[model samples]
Each structure stands twice: as C-alpha cells, then as structure tokens.
Target chain A: MANGELKLLGTWCSQYVIRIRMMFELKGLSYDYIEENFANKSELLLKHNPVHKKVPVLIHRDRAICESLVILQYIDENWSGTGPPVLPANPYDRAMARFWAVYIDDKLPRQLIDTLKAATEEAKAEKIADIHAVLELLEGAFNKCSAGKVFFGGESVGYLDVTLGSYLAWIKAEERIVGAKLLDETKVPLLAEWEKSFLAADCAKKFLPSVERVEEYVRELLVTKWKVTSA
Target chain B: MANGELKLLGTWCSQYVIRIRMMFELKGLSYDYIEENFANKSELLLKHNPVHKKVPVLIHRDRAICESLVILQYIDENWSGTGPPVLPANPYDRAMARFWAVYIDDKLPRQLIDTLKAATEEAKAEKIADIHAVLELLEGAFNKCSAGKVFFGGESVGYLDVTLGSYLAWIKAEERIVGAKLLDETKVPLLAEWEKSFLAADCAKKFLPSVERVEEYVRELLVTKWKVTSA
Candidate 1:
C-alpha cells in the first residue's frame, strides 16, 4: 500500500463495519478491505483500537481511526471534496443528524440484542414492544428530519441513513428468528418505505450483507456466546 | 430574544451541562442559562429534548440541540470564527480528539458511580482499580494528544480538554466520598498536572461547580436514586 492509502479493518456480519463500507461506496473511494475475525482478532485491530478492540478501524496513511461513527466523521472531513458530504452543510442540521445517529446507536442495537436474548415468551414480547417504541420515536425523527424529502440527507443518503440502514439486515434477521415483524409498515409507514428505498440504493446493495448471512451469524451468537438455544 | 439567539437548558451540577457552559465561555458567546430541577424537570427541557429529556440542550434560534457532545460540535461549527476552535483544524487530529472524548465519557462517570454504589469493600476496590486503569489509559492519551503541550488541544483548550475537563468536579467529589485519590500524582501524573492546569483555566473556574457541591449532589444521588448509603 502506498502512503495516504485508505484501508478498512472490518468483519462481514458487523453492521458497524457495513456502515463504513457503505460510506466508502457512497464516496466512490477505493480502498483495501481487510476482514477481521472476532474469535481471533488480529494484532493490527488490537494495536489500532486498544480500548474497545472492536472492528471497523479505518487506517488512512498508516494512522488508525477506531469506532464506526468516529470513522464515518473522519472519512467525511478527510474526503469532503470527493463525496456527497456525509454530514449536513448547515450547522443546525448537522447537529440534528448527529443527535439522531447517536440515538439510533444507543437505542436500536441494544434493544434488538435484548429481543434475541430474551428467554421467555413474555420477555421477548416486552423487548419487542420496547423496539417498537424506539422505532416509533425514530419514525418521528424521520418525518422531522426528512421534511417531506426522500432521505435524511434530503434526496441523498447521508450519515443517519448509513447509521440506521446498517442495521436493516440485523433487524430482518431478528424478525425472522423471533417470528415477528420489527418494522411494521402500518405502524411506521415512513420508516418501512425508507427501508425499501435505502436497500435499493446502489451503495447499500454493494455493501449490505444478506439477511440470511446475518441470521446464521446471530443464531450462532445466541447458541455459542449467549448460551441460548435457538427456537 | 432575537433570531439565532442561544438559550441553554441545564442544571448546574450536571457535568454534561458544564461542558456546554465551558464551550460557550471558550467561544465568548453569551446565552440565557435556564436552571432545571431534576426532581420535576422543566417542561421547556421536556419540549426541547423530547427523546432524552436531558439537559445541556442548546436552543439556538429556538431549535433545540440536545446532548452535550452534539451541542459542542454545533457550537464549534456555528461559531467557526469565534474565540477558539473547539475541535482541531486537522481531520486526523479532530478524529483522535473525538475518539478520546468518547472513551472518557464511556468509562469515567459510570465507573465513578459504580464505585459509589459498590456494596462491598471488594466491589469498591475493584471499581477503583477499573477507574485507575481508565486514568492510566487517559494519561497515555494526554501524552499522545498534547505532545509536550499543556492541554489536549496542544497550545490551547480544545474539544478533548473541555470533554474530560467537565468531569473534574465529579472526579474530585468521587475522591472525597470514597476516600480514594482518583487522580493520583504518582500513577497518572500527567492527568494530575493536566487537571490542575485545566481547573486553573478561565473557562473551568467560571463553569465548574465547587467540589463540595458535587460531593453533596453525589451523596444525595446515592441516597435517593441508587438507594446506596454513602459512607
């Protein structure tokens, strides 16, 4: 690799990793994608992200940037001229984008994981309800943010889109495993519609892993890591 | 208030709120600070931040930007030509600053709270050890980021300084309550020195609450919220 070359350390099943991959595609930036195995994390990943030791570390010019959201912001700032800007141009809009992106990361993933980890039928139902509540809040956010525009970035997929859209596969996989519809069209029509459109996007198609693949990974996670047998 | 006027919905004791206050002072921006009661949170705060309903909500031109970190970035972007830049001009430096800021927020406060809420001496000792480990890492970060300079922002206080600096009062309070020197001079000498310099800075003196106030608040929080009896 040449000096100033971009390289991403990630895994296939990670939504956080997928977010960066999607961003790279969106920017039309070419880079080497180094896949990491979670079971046996590479020294590069460990050295780069000593704190979390998590994947989706973006190595640019031999300097590593860890955390998915942080990586996304770095890419946007570093390659501002090369891409359709990841964050909004206006300061207030940018704040809102950051706010919602953080919200999605804080709420959705944990709730989705809880829904999977739920032992009893009652617990699963309760967790599913919590997920719906979060989705409803996000639905309101979508309406407020989009402002009758197609995407959160208004006619372009930006930061929030990648943040939330990265989880679509997992959401679908969870839905399949739990035998429930997490993103019901009737409840959150806009998000349901947005999902279709986001999935249809060129970058998303190139980067997003298959729902089946995520489903398999999640099932294994439940069995091996979580110590719960699949239904 | 005129259009684009700033109003901060916050409580004095909140370190999250202190961060924004410090940022405002650093930027030399004036704003109306509305004190909120946590026991019965103000409707204004609830209205502004419907999702979190938590403060340090920066209401600019009547548009609310919730979350301290988000608000800090917004202030930086909106007032790019202000007194001092909150974030670094260089992209990679900005990313590093952000990474450390996030790490500080993720580790410190929670560990401090756990230390207070620890039911046993062993638990408290473990939590204290965890905090020391985090501080040790932050000491390394201070060296890496400062690079022979006084502050994390190098020549002046920037994003990372304000972020980790906001928790100074709480750290002091935790030290007092637990009878443990959290920022030990011997262990994390760099952070200890940095703390003194940061506290002596103009913005910190103006914004940071007294250590006694924070100690009282934390003790009360222990009794009421966590149901833990402070020693």
Candidate 2:
C-alpha cells in the first residue's frame, strides 16, 4: 500500500481529469479529489506536476503522475487485480488499444487546434480540410476497432474508449466554434453510432460533459477567441 | 508467436519511428522495414494507415496499426513474452516511465515546432514564451524525477529514456531555429545531464538522426515555414 492518502488534483472541466476519475471509479479505488482553479495555479498542483503545471495530477501517497493517459495505464496496472481488465491480457490487443488512445491524443488535437484557430478564409479552409482528414482517419480506426462489435473492446468499453470518449466530447464544440464539422453520419458513420453508444454507456454518460454546455462553450469560443489567438 | 510477418512503414527522420525501431530491437523481433516518402506516400502505406497517412505504421500480416508510440506499446505487448519488458514490473515505476514518454511526446513538440516555424516577431515572441514556459516546467520535473538518482529509473535507461532520447535529437536543431536557448547547463542542468545520459545509452545513439542534418533542416524550415506553422 502507498504510504499516504491518494489525492487527485484537477479542474472539473478537464476531460483528462474526468478520465482518471472514471478509471478510479471503475477500479474501485478510494482517493481524495482536490479541485484546482486552473485560472489560479495551486502550490500543490505545481509541485506535483512541474512539467505540465496542469492536471489531473494523481498523488499516490508521495508520488505524483501528470499525464492522463499514463495515469490510466498506471491505475489499470495497479488496481486491475480483478474485474474487467482495462488492457488486453494479450499483447497485440493492448498495443492496438494504446495505439488508438495515442492516435486520438496526438493526431486529433492538431486538427482541433487548427479548427480553433480558423479566422481568415484561407485558415478556415485549411482547418476544414484538416478536420475532414482526421474524420476519415477516425472513421477507419473506429470501424476497424468496432469490427462486428460494440466498443474498442469487442464487447464493451476499455481504456481506449475512455480516452476517445473524452476527446469526442470536445470535437463538436470545437467544430461549432471553428465553423466546421467533423463527424456526420454519412461522413464518419462509425463515429456517429460510436458516439451514440458511448453516450448511452453509463460510464461515458456520467463522465462526459453535458452536450448542451459543450455546444454553448464551443460556440462562444468560435464567436470570440478563435481568430485572435494569434498565428 | 504471431501468425504473420511484421512490416514497419516509417520515415527516416521521424523520432517516433526511431522509438518504435528501438522497441523492435529491444524485443528482438525481426520486421520488414519500408521507408515512406511523405510527399509521395506509397499505396501500401496509404492502404495500411488510411487514417493518418503518416509513417510509423506497423503491419502484422496485413493488419496495420499506425502511430509510433502506440506501435511501441503494441510491440512490447506482442513480443514481450521472452524478452526484457518495455513496461516496468512495478506499476508506479511504469507510471513514471509513461509520464516521461508522454511529456516528451505531447508537450515537447509544441516548443520544438514553434522553433521550426519561420515566423515574424509576434509569432516568434509567442513561440518563445511557450518554449520558456515548457522549459521552466521541465526543469522542475527533472528535479522531481532526479531527487534520488541520475536516471529516471535509478541508473538504467527505461521508457523515459526512449522517448526523451528520441526527442533530444531534434532539440539542437530547434535551438538553431529559435536563435535562443532553452536547455542549458545553467538553466536546466539536471535535464542537460539527463540528455547526455540518455544519448549515451546502448542502441540509442545509433538510432537518432545526425544533429547537423537536423539543424540544417530546422534552419531551412525557419526560413520558409515557421511563421505560418507556429502562427
């Protein structure tokens, strides 16, 4: 057992923060949840996660971990003594799982950022193109993942689902703001149903942000700051 | 053993590719290597990785998984039955290892990309600010990770070294583009030595691109693309 109380430092709005929280919930781990006003950085958060100076930073007794995806793997590794395994017992499945997670994290963000930064005609055009490209890729990935099955795992949700679900929450909001769309049923049909299934899933439903709020926030972002963020 | 032959579609300059190659080497799995030309992406590469159309795609038989970091994890899981484990046996150390890798992969690139983008004063200033912020945080992280000893794992190279070593190859080139320093003996001294130790690790040195070439490419990027890119 860890030497001290386990604590998680995060902002409520952060999807990554929600992810680790869900992992803890699924894992049945008891821990302290410390909210940080990201607008005002806290000493504890700063000390625990100096590199990113962000959350959710999980303080495991004395040790702290800063990355959300990494934290998920850690929690799964430590707490997955029983119940549904977060990663595949088989190596190939686990790798594929990690691949999807990393793909969304690494590739999707760029498209989203480009969309967020679209102000001019040319920039908006470029961002839209980027969004389309990402959507195509996501469609391929999710369809392959969902091959004759429901989730990233054949039967149900796994770590990859959690990560992707978190990411999907922000896409529409970003699209609305950037004045572009990503997932249309006709376009990325796989994602359309995946979103439906994911939102309907009790875990994703609880962990994901309310769609209404996300929509409004994304609209506001598009209307207000997307252009002036400076190239 | 897997049922099919493995093929790796990758670019020569990609840090992610190098990381996966190292993992393949570490795992003692023989894979067919096919280099990709980003400008003229091959049909095989496109078919295999339709989503990203990027390098670092691994093919097992005919099923392909794209993304380098993801491939690294996949390779670890698939081939780790008899070889040295890529993930640590202990969960906490595994988290720490993932922490470093994710930090390098996700956060480090922003600053390095900024340095690569040839931009105006405003863009340069924004990028410089971003670079400084990341460096300051990394400084603290290095200190935190190094509180006890030299390596992320006592004295041996682990996951962190793999990610960080791959990235450090680009830093010198990025430094040339920025026309300002980020890592220094005076600034991030711990990280500086950490870099030295990372590069000196077995097989790590052989895997990376030449600094001179990277610097040259980075300089060219600064002249042509940095402004538009970081902007």
Candidate 3:
C-alpha cells in the first residue's frame, strides 16, 4: 500500500518538528516540508490541528496527525517494512524506549525554557542544577537501555534516540546562552558521548539545526514572545 | 510465552491504577494487586520506579513499567493475541486515538486540580470553564472517533476509551464537590452518552471506583495534601 502525498507542516527551529524530520530520514521516507510561520499559521496547519494549532502536523493521504510523538509512531507503524524499525521489536524494549522518550519530553524542554528565561543568576543556577540532576538520571537510563551498545536502540537510531536527540541543538544553544555545560562530560559522560555520536549519525546530522541557528532563534523568541531581554 | 509473576503496586483511589485494573479485566489477565501506602512509601515501589516514584507500576517477570499511558501500551503489545486490541489497528486511527488520549492527559487533570485548589469562586468558575471547553472538544473528538458508534473504540474499549474513561469517576466527584455539571448532557450529548456506556461495560464495571468513594478521597486530598478547607 502506498503512503500517498505525505506532507509535513512545521517551523525550522522546532525540536519537535526536527524529531519528525529525523524519523523520515531514518525511515528513508520523503515528505513535503511545509515551513509554517509562527506569527501567521497556515490554514492547513490550523485546519489539521485545531486543538493545539501547533506545528509538526503530518498530513498523509489527506488525514493530518498532530503531535510529534504521535506522528512518529504513525510513521513507524505505517512504514513497518521500509527501513530499520524506529521502536524496538520486543514489547518490553519498546515500552522502555517509550518510557525514556516520555521522560525526555516531560523534563528537558521545560527545564531548558526555564534556564533561558531565568531572571537572576541564582535562579539560573537553580534551574541548571535541576537539569544536571535530570541528565544524570538519563545517563543511567542510557547505560541500561544501550547495554554497551552505540545508541538507545542498541545499534540504530530508535525512538528514544530521535526523541532526546532532537533536543541536542537546543541544549547546546542553552549552554551557549547561559554559560553552563548541560551535558557535562565529567558528570554525565555517557550522555556527553551519546551527544557526539547522535550528532554525527547520518540520519540526524542534516535534520538537526546548528547550535548557532538555534541560539539566534532563542534570542528572538525571548525578545518577541517571552519578553525576556536580560538574556 | 507465559507472562510470569504479574503484580500491580497502586493506591485504591488512583484513577491511573483503575486504568491498569480495567485493562487487566479487559484482557482477562489476573495479577496480585498490592496497595501502596502513600505516606509510608514501599521500598519495592521506590526500587522499581526510582525516577518518578509514582504508582500504577506493572511488574511482570520482575520487571517494572511505570507511567499509566506507557503501561497500557505495554499491556496491549505484550498480550496482543490474548484480548481485543486496545489501540486501533489502522495507523491513522491509532494516531488519532493516541492524539486524543494525550490531549485528555495533558488538559483534563491539570484543570481538575486547579478547580479543586481554586481559592476564590471566580477562580474556580474560570477553571471549570476551561474544563468545559476541553470537554466540548472531546465531545467533537468522540463524534469523529466513534463515528456514530457507542464508544471511542467503536465496538470495543480502546486506548482512548481507557485513557479518558479512567477519569469518569473523578469527573463525577468534581461535579459533586464543585456543584457544577462538568459533563452537561445538554452541552456534550455524545460524551454524556459515551460515559454511560463506558461505566456499564463489563471490563470497566468492577474496576471503576464509585463516585462517592472518589468524592471522599478527593475531599481528603484537598484537606491533607492541598490544604483546602472550603472545598
């Protein structure tokens, strides 16, 4: 069965959008990347995802799938035989992959935003400390999930890899803005190494926005949206 | 493969726990249900789920899976052939199911908590209004997903059904405490009808905690945890 007329509505600098792009790259699936302007969202985007009206809406066969995680699962399930499976074959491993992916989604982004929007040095440090704690936990998870392998998917870039890996550029940008090492090689050596490998992976390399690009975007976001000029 | 030594560690009044219990009933898989005391945290629960230290942990063959949504998926995949499929088989429908399920989890609980913790009548009304808006959207979703059928899963209970259905008791309890009809039949007729069918379903009947029980538990929660005297 043909997955006809696949179209993706997204913005350039969104980590969530990058996750879907990375999935398409890994699965060897091509899609029409429709870049959506945040200031003025497209009707297609709005019509497809009215609830959130956020980006990363994948329109396949004229049906739109909103939410990046949901979209990733749809692609994996729909294209089960196309390439290396995004989720693991074993049910337990798949569950573990989802557990960590959800953990990343739940924790990392909020902390990153807080770090960027911190009003004082004291507050920024506090947020950084929380992020470090989260990273340490993720480091342990990486060790458990990888089990002496290359990625969270053992050998290939699986769901967890795409999930956490999508934030690599943003983490770097936050580090640049805040003057703190988030993925510290000494503290969370595993994640630090994983970051290096994930960035170099063929599937992720082109999709991940450069740290410099993300830094510029974050600065603009702070000024225009969040009204935080201190950063 | 035999699913060996299944055990569930959860509290009696937790809607999340009820979701797992209902899934078990739906699949006809029995497990030892160990009720955990919230004040006196169990070492086993802590050890199994170190990160969140939350309940609704499903331990199978000495492996623990935490998070309600993740556990539901795990159960569905592990016991795929044993029972009626919880998630829709079609990729697009599955994505829609997940999309709606995530929406319910993301929106409903926080609004309910805010309603409970509202210090002023105005604030409570505002929260209730938000909840009603969410419910209205869900009502539309129910129409689309059910497609004139009885439940969100069409003929049988599914991921979205279990996810949102877990909160039915809590919704009723909130209505009782706040003196507001959250699921107004006049406003959301489809959801109102769906609620009746969900409660009467064989898989969910014995598992769903009664409205009175939930109300009592929520009142206790307000006084003890949230420190609200006026509820």
How does each model score on lDDT? 0.90, 0.73, 0.90
Best model per TM-score:
1
* Candidate 3, A42-117: lDDT as tens digits: 9999899998999999998888999899999999999999988999899998899888888899999999999888
Candidate DockQ scores, in order = 0.94, 0.62, 0.90
Order the candidates by DockQ, highest first — what do you get?
1, 3, 2
Error of 1 at B86 (Å): 1.1
In candidate 3, stretches whose alpha carbon ends up further than 4 angstroms from where it belongs are A1-4, B1-4
**Which ten-residue region of model 2 chain B has the weakest summed lDDT?**
B222-231
lDDT of 1 at A101: 88
For model 2, residues A108-139, the per-residue Cα lDDT tens digits are: 77777666666677887787776677667767
Clashing pairs in 1: none
What global local distance difference test value does model 2 have?
A: 0.73
User: Clashes in model 2: which pairs?
Assistant: A95-B74, A137-B51, A231-B231, B117-B226, B118-B226, B118-B227, B119-B227
Model 1 vs. true fold: TM: 0.97
The superposed Cα distance between candidate 3 and the true structure at residue A82, in angstroms, equals: 0.9
Candidate 2 chain A: 10-residue stretch with minimal lDDT: A222-231
- Pairs with backbone N, CA or C atoms under 3 Å apart (clashes), candidate 3: none
| Chain A TM-score vs. truth, each candidate | 0.97, 0.87, 0.96
Give the TM-score comparing model 2 with the true structure, all chains together.
Answer: 0.77
In Å, residue A227's CA in model 2 sits off its true spot by 9.2
- Candidate 3 residue-wise lDDT, B1-231, digit = tens: 354499999998887898899898888888889999999989989999999998989999999999998899999999999978888898888989988988898999899999999999999999999999999999999999998999899988888888899999999999999999999998999999998899889867888888998999999999999999998
